[model samples]
Target: MPRILLIDDDEQLGPPLAAYFQRFELALTQALRPSEGLALLAQGGFDAAILDVMLPEMDGFELCRTLRKTSDIPVLMLTARGDVMDRVVGLELGADDYLPKPFEPRELVARVQTVLRRRRTAAPAELDPDEWRFEGGLSIAPTRRRVLREGTEVELTGTEFELLLLLAREPGRVFNRDDILNQLRGHEAELYTRAVDIVVSRLRKKLEPLDAIKTLRNAGYALALRRLP
Candidate 1:
């Protein structure tokens, strides 16, 4: 049974979610306060966590950061705001996913399952000698679904990691916005294209030592494999 810790101040939603997940055989623990959730997390293990952005004591973003510092336990943040900034901030703070408030319980369940599945599938493999290495400190560990810099781990949101992995896999291969978006999300490409650019910009900033990724005018982006001293 996958143990899930759900932290949300919405009293009415907690028990029902717990009940719903129980039917699926997931062991669920509900926490109404941030402190309570942190306590449970510190005490030990959980397969995943569903955190609400707005908490009485500490907000989900802070909690997420704190949790990431100690453990890589996948986290899904809940926010009623639905603002893109909130979602971006949550992701930057190392959240696996963010579902806006007033969301359907079933959708929540699906997101939880997706995150868990991703984590489970990400088992580290031995690095191959001929693997592509970006000039900057960035390197992708595909099997592990992790990115590292100078041998130090860099926390990446799920989407950002996918984008980085795809681009890094084929260095110098320019993937237009549509191609990249479709590949990253496993969905049809959007007509209007800024989504891919946005994700790439966010990813580039996180990948260091800087200048490893270059944007092509009227084309797309490519990894600059020329090493930097």
Candidate 2:
């Protein structure tokens, strides 16, 4: 059974969501306070978490940063504010996905199932030697869960790292938005093509001085291994 910890201050929303998840094999736990949520997380061993942006004593973003320090447990952040900045910030903070408030219960369930499925399928595994390296100074160490550019370590969140590795694995191949989403495979939340673009943009900035990726016009992105003169 997959365990999910939901941290939200919305007294009305939590129980209903919990009840809904009960219908499935998922064991849903709710924490109304950030402190309590962090404590439960520290106790360990949850398959994933659903967090709300607003909370008493430490908001969801802070809690997410803290969690990423020690664990790679998948996180989905919820907020009433539907600002693009908030969603992007949450993604950059290591959240697997973000859901705005006023969402349908069925949508929430879909997102949860998607996240859990991705988690199960994306368990770290050994990478093929060919899939692990980029000629222009990029390399993925799957065993270490690290990315190196010009032999220097580049900090990447779990999602960002996975996106980079997936692109790098098949150099020069243009992956459409749906293809990338399917490749990511398991987060039932609404898939935004913009999210993929944002992740790729961030990776490009991080891989500066060694151009390892190129955006193909109207086609998606490709890993360019050949060095530019």
Candidate 3:
């Protein structure tokens, strides 16, 4: 069973949700405060984390920033419905995904399953050459799920890493918004096109100086780097 840490202060939300998750073999652990949640996270044994943006002391984005500094545990943020900025900022802060509040429990479960699946299969057992080297000193090792620039490791979330891998695998192939969304989520989200752009922008920022990603206005994005021999 996968253990999920949910850091939200809603006194009424956790219990019933936990019960519902159990039906899918998911164990949900709730923390009423960010400090408590961080403590639990540090102790480990969590498959993923679900954070609520509106918290008492510290917000979810700050917590996510702090968590990414040490752990790459998949994060699924819960934000207020129609809070576009919250969702975008969460993704930029290294959250694997986000689900707006006022959502169905079934939708939440689907999102959790998607993120967990990505985490479990983010890396493959073999690459034709084990490592992919690109111009401007960027390298990716799919088997290890590691990225490097000028010999230095670049930490990336599972979603970011997968996005990079997808584009890098087919350099110059323009992946439109729908294609990118479908590739990442295993389905298309017509209303979440901005989500795709946010993720791409975040990935590009991490690959700075190399400029490994190129954006095409009104179209989509593609890998800007060329394979190195």
Candidate 4:
């Protein structure tokens, strides 16, 4: 069973939802406060998280931002309002997906599964060995889902890792926005193209001082590193 941490203060919603999740092979652990949720997450063993936007102290967005500093576990945000900006902000903060409040429990489960699937999926074998080494002190271990710069591990969100892997697979090949969206998510939603840019920007920040990705004006982005023998 996949362990899931649910950080929401909905007393009436948690118990029944926990029971329902068991039917789908998901183990749900509910935390009533952001601090409690952070504590539970620090202890490890969670596969993903379901965070609510409205909370007692720190809101879900704040918690998500703090959590990203230490953990890359997939996050699915629950927003009380159906605002696109809320979803966009959550994604910018490293959330994997979002669902509006008053959502069907079944739909929530489906969204959760989708987020988990994206995290669990492996990069194509055409990318080469489980481990990839590149010039400029860069290396990637796909099976372990890790990136290293000069022997030091670089922390990256799931989306960032996928975006890096996709570009690194074809060094010097500029992938346009729509191409990236299709390759990563299998659909060309314009809204998500912007999300891709945010992810790329975040990825570049994490890969600083080594300049591995290059941008093309009016085109797209490409990996600028050469494979190291």
Question: Which model is ahead, 1 or 4, in terms of TM-score?
Answer: 4
lDDT of every predicted structure (CA atoms)? 0.73, 0.75, 0.88, 0.86
Model 2, 68-119: lDDT tens digits are 7777788889966557777878877778877888788788778888776654
Q: Cα RMSD to native, each candidate?
A: 4.2, 4.5, 2.1, 2.0
The predicted structure with the larger TM-score, 3 or 4, is 4
Mind sharing the TM-score for model 1? 0.76
Q: Candidate 3 local accuracy as lDDT?
A: 0.88
Off by over 4 Å in 1: 122-138, 183-199, 217-219, 226-229
Off by over 4 Å in 2: 122-158, 176-178, 181-193, 204-211, 217-219, 226-229
Residue clash pairs of candidate 2? 114-186, 114-187, 114-188, 115-187, 118-186
Clashing pairs in 4: none
Return the number of clashes found in candidate 4: 0
* Tens-digit lDDT string for candidate 3 (63-171): 9999999988899999988877887789889898888889899989899999888766744444446799998999998867789999999988889988998898888
Per TM-score, the best of the predicted structures is 4
Query: Where does candidate 2 have its weakest 10-residue lDDT segment?
Result: 122-131
> What is the C-alpha lDDT profile of model 1 across 152-213, one tens digit per residue?
87777666776676666667788777777555433323312545666677777777557767
Q: How many Å off is the CA of 70 in candidate 3?
A: 2.3
Q: Estimate the TM-score of every prediction.
A: 0.76, 0.74, 0.90, 0.91
